[model samples]
Target: MTASANLWTHTNTEAVDARPLDADASADLVIIGGGFTGCAAALEAARSGASVVLLEAQSVAHGGSGRNVGLVNAGLWLPPEEVVAIMGEAAGPLLIEALGRGPETVFALIRDHGIACEAVQNGTLHLAHAPSGFRDLEERYRQGNRFGAPLQLLDRAETARRTGSERFHGALLDPRAGTVQPRAYCTGLARAAAGLGAAIHEQSPVTRVARSNGAWQVEANGHRVRARRLLVATNAYHAGAEGAYRPQYVAVSYCQFATAPLTAAQRAMVLPGGEGCWDTALVMSSIRTDAAGRLIVGGMGNSEGAAGAIHAGWARRKLKALYPALADLPFEHHWRGRIAMTRDHIPKVVEFAPEAYAVFGYSGRGICPGTVLGTAAARALLGAGAEALPLPVLPAYAERFTTLLGGYYEFGAALSHAAAPRLPV
Candidate 1:
């Protein structure tokens, strides 16, 4: 299949015209995968005066990076209490603190680099899918506030006013969160990294890695690039390479459908405040407007094969129900991606080898967590200081149930979409 039809078709926005890899090269660090984590590592390493080579099988941001929802929110899939509960008080607190600054770091980088990804800092709204969801948001707000999170709890009316929709009960807004055009952001980082003298190679899939005579030998695109350190930044979309490490996580699918730009009047009413919003349902939904006023609605779904059409239809109905003004608006873009989810829901950093690491499993919270963890990991990889990866690497096992679990999620998404009632707003 051509690259455009892949789950990450949003790459059309970032016009990086890099060619395929064809030559052998060497560097101080060899990073596999060119998504958020990989590119962030490349940028950080190059900025640190390390000779870094970043390789991607396809294009940069061709994976989940380009398929992102562009949400720059703090924390992970699990709530603060749950995170602390799973990782214990001290470790969880450190992680929360680190991620809390996720949006700050992201916006700073965007502004510094002038990446044109429609960077909007209007904040993000976490809407409640039900009363229980509101309670959950309340607890999260309390926990986040106690931990210095600048969060605001909004009632249903406030939520309606901000979102321009009355489907939600309530919401929690974090000023630290924002939105961006993801592909542009990734390409911008790559440009900044390359301008800083980092070597970035597209379509250079590293197929083998071996420690021969005390150096790491990485073979990709018929050439061997040797380095002292290696980084496996390929997350859920990883198709295993010969020598790279894979993080232990299940590949959960997240899909989105984008509508045509709203009419002038519709734009004035829908997401008029320019905030990115997501709900609290078990099968949740998200809403946001692009730089051109195109509304994007996303949720968990089977984003591949035969089930894609069903998900697409469900997205159509959901959009109409959410906004009566755009009831007849034809969706212009539909795409999906895999999110890495650990059984425990917290992200994982594995010490696969000496000076070699694999970072994955951000669940659905990519923007802030990915930015923070990727930046910190790059620092850690280069032996910068103690401020690298606040949480310790725990022993993890890749369960055999991952494929089955993925099938179940797909099954549920298909069944749920099929059962969706075509009710009018």
Candidate 2:
């Protein structure tokens, strides 16, 4: 593998030259973080005529939003019934319904804003990695159908034909989902928001935040930003801000390795229908093709850490296992991103202060939930009230043993990847 820079960063075209916040400024709303959620919120708030300012520690899409697998899935990793079970009938169904239209919200933004993110709304496949995994898909199919989702259960033969791999037993297909160049989408949102009069500052990390004189005073890059409301959309990449409450969640790492552009024959033979796919294994893995015909495969592990070599070795083995014909292809890009995982595997919108909220914990489903929740946060911050939000605003949300759990996840992923090659298909 060549192991160059991130494919998304290299391919992103929605360039925005937002300078650092260097002087005193004021806005109706101040947003921290410049990933999907922050950019989406800035766009919504600005379009709604609210004076908005967004600050980013790095450049736009510098966090998880830029490093994602680009799968714009419809809902959470949990099945519909499981969500209902954990969040209850009332709150659960509300989130489920809202996120079910997440793809629509995402694709609509792409279309309306003329984003060149290589959007493909064909669909996604949840492949069964084992017989038990197939059973899980069956239950998911049943739950999805009960919730009025137009899902299809494909048998082994159909799954093989669709994925170009005979390893899976079956698959659950969700037609409402799709993929995009994630970083481009995030930058596009920021571009659209800035065009609508929102002030965006990059490399201006917030250092302190305090409620003073019934407004938020945010210090960043030697500049003071006073706003009536504040929204912290940092998720897993949140840096400590004095007097600002940090979001609590377990941090899980996910990595991706992208091959060089495949030959036309290879592309035609693999994932020809252009559907994103992920298997149902415990240490979950994903496979998809980008617009440039590069095969991107991902798994749960930090690719830039101590276990990086193990993960890279496993990627080569995995590619050989999946497609023997393309075993020798080089991976031109390899990168990793962190995921904010909540205890119940649900995203949280915590009302940390009056008119100030901290939204995070997408649990691996960032693109859709980030867009939806960010838009809703903007509406609420602009006086739309709680009804405008998807999930109810919780007074507080906490997770115990975050550090220990994060360690456990990384250890488990490393062990699984080390053993994955020796396991039977």
- Cα displacement (angstroms), candidate 1, residue 252, comes to 1.4
Residue-wise C-alpha lDDT for candidate 1, range 335-400, written one tens digit per residue: 788888778888887777777777788888776777777778889878863357878764444746
lDDT value for candidate 2?
0.93
Which candidate tops lDDT? 2
Clashing pairs in 1: none
Give the range where candidate 1 is weakest over 10 consecutive residues by summed lDDT. Answer: 1-10
Off by over 4 Å in 2: 2-4
Error of 1 at 40 (Å): 0.6
* Residue 77 lDDT, candidate 2, scale 0-100: 93
Point to the candidate with the largest TM-score: 2
Candidate 2: lDDT of 114?
Answer: 94
